[model samples]
Target: MPRSHVALACLVAIFWGLNFLAIHASLEQFPPLFLVALRFTLMALPALLFVPRPQVPLRWLVGYGLGFGTLQFLGLYSGMAAGFPTGLASLVLQASAPFTVLLGAVLLRERLTARRALGIGVAVAGLVLVGISRGGAGAWWPFWLVVLGAFGWAIGNISSRLAAPPRPLELTMWMAIVPPIPMLALSLLLEGPRRITDSLADSLTAQAVPAWIGLAYTIVFGTIVGSGIWVWLMTKHPAGVVAPFSMLVPVVGITAAWLVLGESPHLLEIIGGALVVGGVLWSGRLVAARGAADPAGPVDVGDPGASAHAVEPAAR
Candidate 1:
């Protein structure tokens, strides 16, 4: 890949990394569930109206929406609001890579390399380390919630693999259509209509300015623009060459949270986070090496919405 394209890939990582802070800001004023519903609602509108439907099956699209659109944000926003450190949430979500590989092996009968298995073990160990460090201090649920969100993201990766839509960005946009109604229903059931109404009513006020800005950043930059560049890069290069760039996201996330949010993570969390990123990068490097050596090997390293039984990019 050219240096310019590689930089574009890194740029996507930065956008997604900063997206965690955006979500944290948006959750300050919007109820987590309602925020999930609203995020998708706005995203789905332009896609449904102007974009052509992706040439994919309905079931896979629905599955993508449920897992990626609905379950992902449902756990992520709630977890962050529940006090999961933004930096840690970013770290934990990388677990989706191993989870996707594991699920693909089990559900899709995909074979895993020894390196893949080892990478997964290291990532899992990292999670355990973080869990022990946090749980020892009596704050554990938030960590688990983000893990659940990561699992949901893994599920989305699986559905995306199965779907294998021709136009990935269009498919991703259409997948947004599946989550709004269900998420809205969930918001009504859990957060209540009063909470939703109050959030909307307050949106016009000065207090909601930051929240709206955060939401716009998330929708435009995080998902749309970030995924757009990701898809374009994948089209221009081999998947293995392109996929490893996502590991940069957690690094960017941690730094952004620490700098902007004044978050200072414990040493243990930092160590564990390093292990997680190191493991994923180890696996990603192996993939890249394999692809370079054998042109016929697995070329499908999963991007945000384009893959088939491929590796995950911590697609948040």
Candidate 2:
């Protein structure tokens, strides 16, 4: 990879990392579902008009949308709104990688290698420690909700793989069409119409500036710019070369949360986060090794969607 492309990749990681803080900020002004609805609305408009629909069937698109857009963000935003810390949320969400592997073995009948099994075990242990740490801090419910979000993300990864669209980025943009109305309906049902109206109105207030800024960052930088650069890098380099940079996302997320949001994680949370990241990296290494060992096997390191599968944000 060119040094320029490497720099671009790092920039994408930074955008994605700071994305958690954006979610944390936006949740302060808009109800979780409502904010998510608006996010998809912005994502789908204009781009949906310009980008051709992916060549996949409607069922696949719908399934991907529901899993990635609706379920994933619903749990994530709600968990954040429920007081999940930005840094910890970033670390915990990495559970999606192992979750995706497990789901693939069960649903797609993919083989589970010993290395992957060991990685999964380590990740699960780290997750348990994280849960215990957070629970001790009185954030049990929100932590679980984020874990649910990670599972939704895993399901979405499978859905995307099943869809196998020729253009992954276009499919992602089109899937944006699926979330707004349903999420809005959910917001109305759960948050109540009155609360939704109040929040929408309040978004125009001075206090809501940060929220709106956060929304803009998510829509523009996080989704459009970050995904665009990721797709570009994938085209320019092997997926293995680009995918590891995604591990930096949690690093940036945790650091940004600490610096910008004044979030200081507990010592246990820090240790657990290290274990989780290490485990995920270990899993990824095994995948790369498998791909190398059998070039004609199922693993396709050049697949455009591989990076998305590994690190694509739910809100993204």
Query: Which candidate has the highest lDDT of all?
Result: 1
**Alpha carbon deviation, residue 76, candidate 2 (Å):** 0.7
Cα RMSD of all models vs. native, in order, equals: 4.6, 5.5
- Number of the top-ranking candidate, with TM-score as the measure: 1
Can you write out model 2's per-residue Cα lDDT over 20-100, one digit (the tens) per residue? 988888988899999999999988997578999888768767887888778888988998889988888887776766776
* Pairs that clash in candidate 2: none
Off by over 4 Å in 2: 1-12, 225-247, 286-316
Q: State TM-scores per candidate.
A: 0.87, 0.82
Model 1 root-mean-square deviation: 4.6
